[model samples]
Target chain A: MESFSRIPSHIGIIPDGNRRWAQEKGYQKKDGYQHGITPGFQLYEILLQYGIKEATFYGFTKDNNKRAKDQREAFTNACVDAVELLSGRDANLLVIGNTNYPAFPEALKQYANHRVHFGRGLININFLVNYDWEWDLKSLMENKCLASHEISRIDLIIRWGGRHRLSGFLPAQSVYADLYIIDDYWPDFKTSHFLDALRWYQDCDVTLGG
Target chain B: MESFSRIPSHIGIIPDGNRRWAQEKGYQKKDGYQHGITPGFQLYEILLQYGIKEATFYGFTKDNNKRAKDQREAFTNACVDAVELLSGRDANLLVIGNTNYPAFPEALKQYANHRVHFGRGLININFLVNYDWEWDLKSLMENKCLASHEISRIDLIIRWGGRHRLSGFLPAQSVYADLYIIDDYWPDFKTSHFLDALRWYQDCDVTLGG
Candidate 1:
């Protein structure tokens, strides 16, 4: 693995193109959940080994619920499985999203929302499920309870898909995030791609609009 | 100019690296403003010619106010001059920024914020000066009068001078903006570069996080 002189303290991951990958692989979208779930656990281990403190995964957005029922169910089940696997391990798990959204009732309910599991590892893993950009800000606007208790400014945002746009992942928090886009589909993602993203972030000259 | 199958109705331009261009040219920072001012007017004309209706320019940010007094004055003067020049043309001019700031006391006094100058041209131009993302959102939180009355969602956000981060420009509005980055400095920016950005936006498969 290539060494990074400065690894981002907080990194955001947008896992996209899982269903598309399933189609490309000539499998039903329901069968694609297996590929998506395994790599995320592997990534969490990789990130922990790298000693990265904070990482947020854009697991599911409210808009994703608009997809076909079977597709939505498959993605949700995949996300829950990943979260359950991660929660059993060390580190804090924080989920930021509207749990009350009619589409998603209980997604890793025990570990979903703002419950942090005190664990052996030092890294903090946040799973953003059913997250909407406006709703996140709407909470702030009303001086109401924040969806998630703790949120940090993301330093590097890696999107695994061909898309270049943010896709509404913590819009305010990503104000100065250096985005690294990967052409590989989320399900077919390799660990090498993750390392390359870290290396790419190291090459960025982040002046923060000075 | 190359044709685009899909042109963004609303575009946001982040004009960056003007001072760097000046330094590279072995000129004073103050001299850079003169170069930055001209292309903006030219861009407005280009947008009008291209049949683009809405355009916003990051003329100055609240962070820019933190620079040396002379530097701030020079840039502020340049922005005011650009706004004045655009105002004279027949287009709706709306400036999105905090006017009470010490930096920009009187920038086209009567037509500074929210005053629409409905002109013969179909293009609508907005110049953001002394604008800050947090402050803009803070008003909505406090129930106080907003700094700017009108704001539009940006479809394509093009930043000059090779920076990828948004740098706190309309965070909520840019939730799904396809960002286009140019290595060319703002002063040296060309109409061709603008056209390329439009063309690039046309190619982006913006699914809006679905």
Candidate 2:
């Protein structure tokens, strides 16, 4: 894609609205999660085509641990499967955050190792499990670890269905990041939507350059 | 005191140029910090007269702890003394985190207790000691522990020499919050500047009246 010239080096996604999508389609919530995999795959492929090097998917937040065990297990399995499939791709995969619930660190660790063996970086498919934004921010700021200059240089950020608040993910970096918000459920996001976001990002880059 | 009608409910100060202020005045940095107390007192009186309820003072951040222990101890003692004096005036005081070098919680607990004993909720003073904006913002967004609302609902936010990039304070509340930045050094802030900021706050409040 010629538009690859403007694709972001790192793209973060807030995958939201799995329950709503499932209910809307008269499927069990687990089914909604299962269905979500297709769109995720499509988006990943499109990002790859556009030459995006890094993608962070907001999978299960710490809050997700509150769901029923069966649902949680299903979601976790989906995540592991997604990671396994993506491992075969050229891009790296990382699963971030401490997997505290379901005591699934071993499972996550095993998948992460597999991804690495497949040639991805140690943290390529990052999943923020049991993450606390407040503690992290405090540590960074106090330690003077904020990479302010680097972050302000970002080209684009794509938010899927989640609201537009910094959420402690690179606040300093966002000042210069072109932002795109899609109203559709994250699980329903398609390749076309991803491309549309990329187009908007390209337009922003051109405008900013001019 | 006619400006009291336009006073800001919240005011923030960045005490910069301590070493420079000291050097210019032909005094040691310690002397500069001591000199800062006089203007600080004047500012407090002005804020009180103007009916401002919240005043955030940027004291030592985590980075400050890296200074010689003797110097750090001196600064901490000075801060403690200042709080003691303010506590005598029946002020509601809070110590905000720069989070890297945590002040002894006991110190703050003692001061808070003293304030409760003094019987005054009319004045609230907070020291953003080693404060990290990222942690604060993240807690507000993910924890649900923070009372979440629209960002637009925030009456006013004052940043004294603070940068604009949200840094880590992301997912800005849905409501729009009024922002004010002052150029004056925190230690040198005067009653006139306080009054001016208050007037602006009043104007903003009126413009966005509930």
Candidate 3:
């Protein structure tokens, strides 16, 4: 593996198009979220290998809960499973979101707001569950504290499934993020897709308007 | 000349690469900003022809003032010129920025915060001068109101000069913007580039995370 001279300290992941991927594969929309779990693990291992300091994954959004009942339950459960999967790993995992909402997973509420160490805690992992951009920013207005205040600024944001839009990602943190998009769906995660993004990041100005 | 059945009512423009474009043309970096003015008018006309309701153009940023003295002056003057250029046109013009700072142009102080109607006010134009994402969102924390409260949600964000990053262009409003990148520099503005982006946006699943 070619090592990067300047690896991004924090990477934001938008694993999109799972349902579309499942539909194309002739599976129920609910079944797509299950397949996305392995990709999360695959990306985690890759991040660990690269010694990336932190990562934030889009688990499910508040708007995402607007999905059909079965689809919503599937993705919500998938997020819980993903967090549990990281429990035994060497990660400082924290799930940030609106836990007050019923869409927030009951099993994952333990990981919300505060970071819990799993093993050596080599990398910081932030999983956004039932997250909303308005809800995230509203904290600053209503409470004078951000729910996502613990997470640092994102250096690069990689989105799967060919969407160019941010879809309400952490706006404050992602202000200067170098965005990379992959046409492949989240279920069809490939190491090369991530590697390609890293290579592209090397050439970015990364000057934050300086 | 073809009209779109579904035109994005509000479009955000990130006209990047003025310095690079000037350097490539064997001109001083300061000269780049002057050349970018024509494209602004061209884009405005196109938007008016298509009956697009609102548009936002990224002027200089607070960070941009960190550049060389001449370069800062050049871009600052360019933003002032761009706003003045729109004064006689049929648009509602507003400049959002930190006017308290010395970096903001004196000529643009009147346009800040409040929207001034031009001839007939057929379209709304927002020019972000000395804008910062942190500063824009910080208003919510300290003042309980956004500095950019007048702007509506951005439907599509078009960036000229090949960069895929947002570089802090109205973060709150751009949560669901369909980002389109054109490798061509701002000085090299072609109507076809805007047309191509519209064509791409036509296929976008603009369903805000639903």
Candidate 4:
């Protein structure tokens, strides 16, 4: 078994390139969402196995919602399905997003901005849906200071599908995070890939800029 | 002449591994700071030549203050010298960092939190010295909202040194920024490396998660 001397306390992920994955497979862009949904749980299982304290997934962003209507619908459905699948798991699930968006998935309606099954298990899982950095910053302005640490500071950020940008996953939370990028699309995500990221995180000297 | 279809509007950089660079050369860690100082100007020359709009350097962060006194002194001197060197230039220069830090460079006292020498080159140059993410966030809380756009949203972030983390380089500005990392240390940085980053960026499809 692969081992890391240290495991990041909280990891954030941006799984990208579903449309490209679908197009390359000669499938419709919507079909890619179906394939993309499975990796979320796979990643969670691995994080849980390692006893990682927390994991955050970029479920969907405002920028993501602006995609073609069909693409948006597919993504919303996939997230709902992923939530349904995770509901049976032994973990705390929280959805943090701008639920004000019109197409916010109905399946996650009850869990919006709240933690569900809080007493469940070894890991805390966060999914951001219809999230926007601008929206989050705006709220910070109005609220003065947030009392609750809703978003844990990210230790590592992994982006799948070869893209190098955060696309506004969770900037405030990612302030001091290490970033890892993989060319593999979300649908093709493997346990080995997750292991490799953990290993990479282990190799880093977390000087925090010192 | 090298060309890019779209050039980034603002670029943020984290120059790392100066000590490691010195160690590799069989010299004291402090000696590396001397070699690292010149590259900042070299990078500016290249960016100015290319007419790139803006560049931000992570000259020092608050966490960096925790290093050995000698090391911290070396970094502060290097930054003060760099700021003094740029003071005579045609570009606008700004320093975004915690000036409250007792050891904050005396040479940079004039340019603190304000843009300096708003003239010559088309490029806007920002150097972050003694910066802390938490400090900036706190100021945002007190002042209501930042006016005059203290930091332009970063388009691309490049870190020299093999590490892949931002280590607290301007998280809010980096919300949707593309990240590029190089294995070379700051002292070893070359103009060719900057050009290569532009080339790599040109090949990216900046869908911004849509």
Which candidate comes out best when scored by lDDT? 3
Q: How far off is each candidate at the interface, as Cα RMSD in Å?
A: 1.8, 12.2, 1.0, 1.6
Least lDDT summed over 10 consecutive residues: which range in candidate 1 chain A? Answer: A140-149
- Over B88-138, each residue of candidate 2 has an lDDT whose tens digit, in order, gives 676676665533335533465454311233346567776654444444444
CA lDDT of B159 in candidate 3?
A: 98
Decoy 3 TM-score against native: 0.99
- Point out where model 2 deviates above 4 Å: A2-5, A111-124, A129-155, A166-179, A202-210, B1-210
lDDT of 1: 0.80
RMSD of 4: 1.9
CAPRI tier for the interface of model 1: medium
lDDT of 1 by residue, A1-210 (tens): 567888999999988888779889999976776788878878888998898999999988887877888988887887778776876789888877886766554756666666587568578888888788777777765664335537888999999877878888887778889988898998887899889888888888866655
Better of 3 and 4 by DockQ: 3
Candidate 4 stretches with Cα past 4 Å from truth are A146-148, B146-148
Query: Model 2, DockQ value?
Result: 0.04
TM-score of each candidate's B chain against the true B chain? 0.93, 0.67, 0.98, 0.94
List DockQ, one per candidate, in order: 0.66, 0.04, 0.84, 0.73
* Count of clashing pairs, candidate 3: 0
The global Cα lDDT (0 to 1) of model 4 is 0.82
lDDT against the true structure, each candidate: 0.80, 0.53, 0.91, 0.82
